[model samples]
Target: MSQTIDNRQFRLARRPKGLPERDDFDLVTEPLAEAKDGEVRVAIDYISLDPAMRGWMNAGKSYIKPVGIGEVMRAGAAGTVIDSKHPDFAAGDKVSGNLGVQTHAVFPGDELRKVDTSLADLPVYLGALGMPGMTAYFGTLDVGQLAEGDVVLVSAASGAVGALVGQIAKKKGASRVVGIAGGPEKCRYVVDELGFDGVIDYKNEEINDAVRRECPDGIDLYFDNVGGEILDAALANLRLHARVAICGAISQYNVTGNVGDTGYAPRNYLSLLINRARMEGFIVFDFADRYPEAAREMAAWLSAGELKHREDIVEGFDTFPDTLLKLFTGENFGKLVLAVER
Candidate 1:
């Protein structure tokens, strides 16, 4: 705290119509603030780039409030504490929170969760040990209500949330776990690396046909990350009493106008009625009180090598606008993380 630091941040300049452009944000450098009583100042190390970020840029009623124009862009970030005025946190402690798109930030100590670097890397906290992990955990087990011997299908299978959903399903005794991902490389990773029973390369194959082929007996649980046609494809193959966990709709996140007007809605939804399936959408924060429970199990899986996670690390805080597009473009192989340059 002795030396003055300039904190650079991306503030929302305007609401983006479709995909966010660099102009949508104004990068400003300002003097960093000192931590007040019970507050901590952190030097950000990594920022999470997620599909949900696109939705947050819009102005409307949603799970979370939209980032106001002129406000720092909202983002989940992990960092090392530069200074702390809280009893529990000390300087050099690693932490993660909704720290926004900035090089440094200050927040109440209760708002930041201290992380252990010994168990995992700092970036890993923004991936498997963070919101994405919590989304996959509760989305599969709680919302999807996965059952043993069920045939599970996961859309965006190689993503931060989808990848973990497939693996968690398999570990919980699912008879088969199938993933839907774009491109051959992602398909291979979902199967060869993540241990999914099979994967459909959405880029090469028709999603509906591929879903039917991979899940011939129909899917008992579908954990959907990329909605639209992929969601329709999963819906068409639902088994009796199937459960669908709608974790995200990345395919529709960039719609220019009203989502229902411009986005792709399912055409095969009738299958849900025929199969008596349940489709539910969930926000990870809904299960916030139980985060420690999920973290313990996820950590155990990581320690035992039962779960595998990958982080697509992009260097430089300036790359955030372009980096986030990777999620919609299917360029990121795993969890997309932005490493803030010193």
Candidate 2:
């Protein structure tokens, strides 16, 4: 028998000012249509709420188009297939794709990847074994060009991607791994739990001073997640021929004004020239072709107990708007996933 399910979604009520508010999203329920040829309908289990979503909301030039007014907010999601018309996928198959923020999504079968459930949990596909993990893998290896015995420093050390960056650097034979995170608890987790060589509590200490103390020899590779002042500080402590991977900049996402002047600027531009360092920004989507390769490696590490992942799962689909705010505030402990289904 054919069944109809209620599809609840969070729409952009309006563009945000500073931090996005509840009013910015309008919760609406609709009826989903049946799948056509080459399509698959997903009952989304977990929706990934990332800092990158903030940039997607703004009407500006970016890697992808901004979420238009009254459109469903863009996001990455993992779920199970209830219906399929595509040749590659079948009913009851588990898949992960960018399904936006909704209880159900009908997308082209070619857009989705069938996941192996036995290897890891479903939410891990949205996190450690997913986009965040891939971001850390490619950003550090290709962009940062990390070499053996190089000193690697990561900012936003306890978040999804940052946590993986530190761990991967360690596995690749980094001589020293330093992490900068907000609050004492996260700092402790990065060092004690994640096996980072040192940690800097950014909330309590001056970032520049902390970097100087933790990295006496300067940083060979800097995996920047939280930019702004910390980015500037990292620039001041770059070693000769240092590589800086600009993965994210959550610190300046909510700001309404100009970033170049109002925000913290690196006073060490001269040092970049003198040290012959290179700074490059990359989006994970740029390495989409190599996702399978990266996923294989990350999964092997997870299975071997060499890689660790954490998830901060918030219950209920209705809490999507509120839960997303947690990432900006650092309220989430790990990869933040919104559980839409019971």
Candidate 3:
């Protein structure tokens, strides 16, 4: 900890178009700064790769600010506190926070939270034990107002948040849980492994008909992650008083246009009115303070083998840009993560 270690950082080099490419980010190395008073220096272990990061790369106002050109691309990461100058943190404490896309980070101690590796692996802290998990919890249980025996349908049902939403609904007593994934493999995993009632292979199947077939009666809750055609298809099957938790729009995140353009909007407004269903969007940060409460329940589920989490981790910080593309193409099988090496 005494000797200075080099920090490699990936900064936003320019605004991206359609989908991000390698040139959109610039990688550079610099000497790690010393931890000043009330600050801690962490040796980052893993970087979270999420579909929402694509939206943060654009040039517009969003739920979160865009990653400014030349700034380290904002990301959620976890690592060990190698050096600390604050009363609340110790040198050996593992922590999680907005550590960015870097090999090391130095920030105010208040910005990081201690991580207990005994509870889960560090990368799990970036996945099931992280924002994705919290989003699924509040979005399904609270926002979706999921009730016992409700029939639920969720888009991107095999991805990070969607996977949990489907399983949680079933555990909470949903009579049927149908998932819409991109392929046969993901569809099988969602159904056979996650205990969903059925799955629609959106990449190769007719979505509207499949949803109707899966939830013959009608869908009572729709947890949408892909917002384009899939959303419209899900809307077509909503039952009376159905609720749609708008967790994300990964399908539209990379859709860009001239500055100030509002981007892709779903064309199924009539369905919401006809069925008297509610569609609401949420940010996981809004429930930050309640994370511990949610994590405790999730841990119990994990301990009792009721919850399953999978991470598709790629190594090396150099693969940042290319690795991000895996999300849009649906190549990443689970919560994508980058294992950083120092």
lDDT of 1 at 234: 87
lDDT of 2 at 303: 88
lDDT of 1 by residue, 1-342 (tens): 379989999999999988889999999999998889999999999999888888888888788888999999999999999999998899999999999999999899999999989999999899899999999999999998888899999988999999999999988889999998888889899999999999999999987788889999999999988878889888888889999888888888887633434478888888889999888988999999999999999999998888899999999889888988888799998999999998
Candidates sorted by lDDT, best first: 2, 1, 3
> What residue pairs clash in candidate 3, if any at all?
none
lDDT of each: 0.91, 0.91, 0.88
Q: Arrange candidates by TM-score, highest first: which order?
A: 1, 2, 3
Best by TM-score: 1
Error of 1 at 140 (Å): 0.4
Error of 3 at 60 (Å): 2.1
Candidate with more favorable, higher lDDT: 2 or 3: 2
- Model 2, range 146-199, lDDT digits (tens) per residue? 899999999989999999999999999899999999898999899999999999
Q: In model 3, which range of ten residues has the least summed lDDT?
A: 256-265
In angstroms, give how far residue 204 of model 1 lies from its true place.
0.4
Clashes of each: 0, 0, 0
